[model samples]
Target: MPLEKIKVIAFDADDTLWVNETFFRKAEEEFCALLEEYLPKEEANKLLFDVEMQNLPLYGYGIKPFTLSLIEAAIKISNGNMTIDLVQRLIEKGKAMLQEPIELIDGIDETLRRLSEKYRLVMATKGDLLDQERKLINSGLENYFHHIEIVSDKTEKQYKKLVKHLDITENEFLMVGNSLKSDILPVLNIGAHAFHIPFHTTWAHEMIDDKIDHPNFRSFAKASELLQIL
Candidate 1:
């Protein structure tokens, strides 16, 4: 498998195109602080992540689900003794996050601008549909993408569907993103090419420990680096 076969290049949203995980991390710190009396910051953070994983099937991903998880975790951490005021604050926190301005990743705009000229670019990511769309519009990179594929989760099956929908074979698709778990591994498993451009922060649920050594997989430190090889 070489670069010449790649016909469609799909990019992950959130941390891949712009800033995302940092807000979640900051909110988590604040969340733990708000619940400091009930649990230490480290323990509270772990509990929150556990609650999120448990709720994923029901709620999917986004600020709304995260907000709900915050409330649920808060109640559980406080033995169901948390006040309504605390819940209100969590609600407000989620609203603030949804309204936060988009910050493009360094070199991402240039990378996208350049790549769009050579390939059929698509934004293939998983998250709450409305929120992801909002970010895409605000990101100002929407025009560069020929198609947008937003799913509840990124998996081998989903990747296969995307390739079919694009009227391309698995070997003709290339996925670029920050998370190895959601963005890199599954795409590669589907016999597609994948490039990992890791962000500084990653959600606990998206973390993985395995070393990747696939022939179709490559890792880079920044978005611009894609130009050198692509």
Candidate 2:
């Protein structure tokens, strides 16, 4: 069905807007290499992923925990070879990931520009507040959004809160995002519409198990196609 009358167009940050996952992947590769002295590359990767999956609730999402995971993995594989210097380096890498602004996903600006003209574009994302804000500002896409939300988690409550704050109802709102947990599920749960634009890599912390059967649950093959519906 065509979303011919969309009013509030919301978005998820990170990979939805830019090349975020690739950085994490690169860091993960470097992280695995760091542990090669004690564990084979395959085993190091498996264990690191295992630890990340196990630490979601405790650490939540974003570079902080991913960095912590690297630190923990390095310590575990030290075999008496891990030193304070290595630990410091791991911390610095983590800080750099958050501090540095990666490139925006290709075609994001043109797509946002086209959509913004006809809808009340808003940013709806969850993460470290300051970090997410910095990414948006540095992205050079902040001006397009009239409202911005930096949430701790994505839930029906948060979706409704945006609706209430924006003075729009389910029919007028459309949440476009990459994560099923943070992007698609919550907004769709609140009787609102959503565009599920899948990313290549999804962080384990953002995983959610939910039934996706709704009239408003839309799917897209690319970010550029998002403008077609609006």
Candidate number achieving the greatest lDDT relative to the actual structure: 1
Model number with the top TM-score: 1
Q: lDDT tens string, model 2, 169-193?
A: 7878898888988788777778888
TM-score of 1: 0.98
Write one digit per residue (lDDT tens) for candidate 1, span 150-194: 999999999999999999999999999999999999988889999
List RMSD in Å for every model shown: 0.8, 2.3
**How far in Å is the alpha carbon of 22 misplaced in model 1?**
0.3
| lDDT, residue 195, model 2 | 88
> Which consecutive 10 residues in model 1 have the weakest lDDT in total?
197-206
